[model samples]
Target: MIKYLGRDDNGIRKVVLNLFLTGDKFTTGEVYDFLDKGNFEVSYRGVSAMVGLMNTRLGILSINVTGDHNVYSLKESYKNIVGSVLENY
Candidate 1:
């Protein structure tokens, strides 16, 4: 957790946003793989934890944990907002 004045929520949100930018549903391992390949230093444990927080607490993602590998996708409400921003950029 990267902290600024004793809080790391911003850092966690950034991680979730980056995952959202991938534009595809991804597993926790897949997220770690993507970050690793990009040379971004992040722990798999941290990613897994943050993904869960985003799904359950922040409501930024939807997760299906019933499969062999859990899959995560951006929530529909966020998708439309992100889609519009991406289109303009």
Candidate 2:
């Protein structure tokens, strides 16, 4: 998880790529499990902080908190962004 993101120069970029490549948005706990199982470098707090930051960095969708559960999803516009990356890649 972190390895893929770590390649990007920006923390937010690293995080967004992780989200993109994983192909789905995930809850914090789910992401926590993934990182732990994968033995990634990010901490739970670190993932939470990065989710919040993506809202500002992407200038689009933001994480929504529900019943004390925080859910992260890509903004609608991200398809356009992903298309560009896919084409370039």
lDDT of 1 by residue, 1-89 (tens): 12211255334445456568656798989888876786677899988886787678667678887658899998777876655544543
Q: Per-residue lDDT of 1-89 in model 2, one digit per residue for the tens? A: 23433455544454345554445667877766665676567788977666566566554444777898877776676767755564554
Scored by TM-score, the top model is: 1
User: Candidate 1 — which pairs collide?
Assistant: none
State TM-scores per candidate. Answer: 0.67, 0.62
Per-residue lDDT, model 2, residue 3, is: 41
Q: State candidate 2's TM-score.
A: 0.62
In angstroms, the error of model 2 at 49 is 1.1
Question: Where does candidate 2 clash, by residue pair?
Answer: none
The 10-residue segment of model 1 with minimum total lDDT is 1-10
